[model samples]
Target: MTDPSVVHAPAPAPDRIGRLGAGVRGLMQHAEEAAGLAQRPGLLQGLDPRAKVAGAFALILAAVATRSLLVLLALFVLATALAAASQISPARLARQVWIVVLGFTGMIALPALILVPGTPVLSLPFGLAITEQGLRAAAFLTGRSETTATLALALVLTTPWPQVLKALRCLGVPRAAVMILGMTHRYIFVLADLALDLFEARRSRLVGRLSPAEARRLATGIAGALFERALALSSEVHLAMIARGWRGEVHLIDDFRFRPRDGGALVLAAAILAGTVWAGSVWP
Candidate 1:
């Protein structure tokens, strides 16, 4: 006896819950991909973690110390080459590192074009002008940011997190600092998974889209519940660690060995850093 002419409304989309779950899943996938990259038979992956860490540090220092745009470009090219040798896809680099850094740095550099006082390159309305000095400054800033990020990302992608932590410890980093970093990295995934589960449960229980007030209340309640659960989990983890006789030290199965290739890599990095400094000082 239902009327055939009656119109029906579409269901409301679970925008907030869906987006949160998707973001969490994306993070989890990114972490897994990074771990898989570390296991690949690539140039940086084959080197000792300590050597890789040192080399990355040297390259970063070179990037920071150089004032020449050409030098920064060279460093960026070198980083890209290293990434390729390490089996990283150019599209991945463009998507993850280059585009992100360029976008962020571009925003910061945009104002410099009109603010810097020099020979005017282009004139804008309201007596504003883009100067050669400003253009150079912006390019230098953007190039330096991009180069540094590329080098850092290359290191992170090719080295396992545990090995990187061990390398840091071996390189005279404070024990407490390393411990804190290790704990933070470990628990991030745990918290993400818990959040995803909570989101899923909430989504399943909902009959329709939440009102503004209802959504606020739900978010507040979820935040409180997550905080409580995180604290409880931390306590349980600490107690378990203590019960297992952990005395503020991390042990890994893979002991580091400095092979010939590792030594050569370190020396090459040092040489490049030295050359970059010399070139930067002498370049007009």
Candidate 2:
């Protein structure tokens, strides 16, 4: 016996600080979810970290070097297949990459569809015409961007952060650089937690909508507190590490070994990279 005329009132709009805080929280949650995916049994999970890193880098390079649309399409297909094998949802991958890649690149490429000179596909207003060349160029650019993006995300999706840093070190990256990268990643999560706490505290105390001035003042306070907190946390972390007999270097029990499978994976990646280069060269 529900009343047909019943309606719910709209929720009040969040102020700028609230919106920003929500964004921060969402990013933290999303990153944590992505990290969780690495623990799942998937295609790339058991491979040597070095092999995955090498293969992903090779694919990305091939994608960037190719100008042929067909070759680019092939790279995209390869990336998609890898994602599927790794138990990644195709729809989620597309949602994460396309929205950002296409949002900015699409805006840049849209003009080329009309401005680049070639065989006219369609005449437009102001004497501009859509050209076959422009369309092809735009498609190639977008395909390259998307394919590379997919591979990069796939790398993160497949590998844990520590292993990724280890792979980087094995790849001849400077130890200092690797350490900096690791610290940066860890600190990002720390700061995210801090932001979430600040936001939650503010939210709990908030009884009404904030005036613009109040919102601005609160945002400034939050930023200042975050900066101070970061310094304190960093010092505490360093001291704790020292207390635990930790050196400045990272140590992992899993030493990278190029097993037979790792070699096989590298060979397969090389073959695909060769095919991409050959196709792009012959076609273009």
Candidate 3:
């Protein structure tokens, strides 16, 4: 008989820089989003994730349906307002959009689309002559891409993580996805805390620069630690489930209801969408 724990478990990182970098970035983004914010909801947090999601989609659809710069401009303003009301810091919100801004900026730069697909000019000191058509296409593409991204960020900022997950479950989102989210959301912080602790301990113990072998060993140790922690959590959860009631089918608690807020939320979303679309039509 094989040791089930050792056989099936993922191996720890061997001082893996790539995996560690990814983990650290994700950890920082979450910490930055929630840190130093008020404990209670300001106003937007009171709104349901579904409501926020709906509003975001409406904004996106309106922008997508119309190529007018006016519609895209409306989406930009609406998205910024919603993000502000979420109570997260401007820095954090900027972090969310950092990638979008960078990517779009690069795409619009003179050297990108101006250069033909097959042609490569080694020396164009002044840079390629970007055509008017290419510039317009780039602008249009950037606007559409940014509209969707802003919607996603707004939904994330305004909607509490658990409520977002719950809303997804309520909306008949796949059980597998819900389960993964449920488990990950609950334990992500725990893993982050553990990683931080381990890192601090290792740094404190370090003397001189480590050898290549030592670095690999340390990387592997971190991965091993994460794997064990996750597996232990899974076992604990499984045991608790068995203790209460053994069943293959999972159940979601019935907590959501059609309150007056729901209607009000939808009305506000409709009004914003309608007003934006109407305004787009009139803008010369």
Candidate 4:
């Protein structure tokens, strides 16, 4: 009973967790999408990637320098508010990250909230004592993680991958790991482009109507094709690498002149962080 046009036209790709919100899975998706988005022009996008790195560092520094619950809360609120203000898609972003947060993180967080060292033996369902310190500790840990994660996302969203990865290298990340990251990122697109071409070719041809068996066939066929192509690509890459004198090290070009926007990004980041923390102190 499907419409002829609906069955014929290609469906759009599903929105990934990056397109939704910022939970654990969403955070990962957000990281991926934000990397692509960082290339686009946005209010925060034009600043030097270095500035974004510095700002992210500063936010984390600010978070560590304070132990106040109000300060922590301020960080959380600022992160959430800024995310919304960015006009980024919320529901999509939330779907990407929060599910993992809810499932795995909440698993640990929920119980810790109900039990801890030296908690008052309050009457509860499972004879658990909810201590004030326990609550504070859990909130502080979770809030710090959440705030830091958001601030990191802001940096990643604003900064390009090359600058960030390079910065990571300068910050003492192991060379091999960084090199691996470099290679993997370079190849992901090569792989994805291949997949996209195949998908397009399929769509170009008049494909069958969606049936249970057909859907399974489509998925399996796509997977098998990808696997075969991947093997071919690996062999070709190996030959190419052997032909070219590609040593273990891969160099990246990163030489952008600092602009006034870089200075502004740092100042704005500092001002926001300072204000957020100060506001928390006054509120608490």
Best candidate per TM-score, number? 1
Q: Please list all clashing residue pairs in model 3, or write none if there are none.
A: 12-223, 12-224, 13-219, 13-220, 13-223, 14-220, 15-219, 15-220
Can you tell me which runs of candidate 4 are displaced by over 4 Å?
Answer: 1-36, 61-66, 81-93, 169-174, 187-232, 238-254, 260-284
- The stretch of ten residues in a row with the least summed lDDT in candidate 2 is 246-255
Q: Per-residue alpha-carbon lDDT of model 3 for 18-73, expressed as tens digits?
A: 45655766776766656424245655566656666666667777766665676677
Cα deviation of 87, candidate 2, in Å? 0.6
The TM-score values for the models, in the order shown, are 0.92, 0.89, 0.65, 0.61
User: Best-fitting candidate, measured by lDDT?
Assistant: 1
C-alpha root-mean-square deviation, candidate 4: 7.5
Clashes of each: 0, 0, 8, 13
TM-score of 1: 0.92
lDDT of 4 at 269: 75
Compared with the true structure, what per-residue lDDT tens digits does model 4 show for residues 1-284? 87767657678554221122122333345457876776666655666656767777877877765568777777667666655555444563466444545556666776776666765645567667777777776776666766776666666666677777766665567878876877787677666666666665555563445555765676568769988998899789867986897654534676655698878878977986787667667764
lDDT of 4 at 26: 38
Task: Give one digit per residue, the lDDT tens place, for model 1 in 165-257.
Answer: 889989999989988988899889989999999989999899877887888888788889989999999999889988998765667986889
* Whole-model Cα lDDT of every candidate shown, in order: 0.91, 0.88, 0.65, 0.65
lDDT for model 1: 0.91
Off by over 4 Å in 3: 1-41, 99-101, 104-112, 115-128, 208-217, 228-261, 271-284
Clashing pairs in 1: none
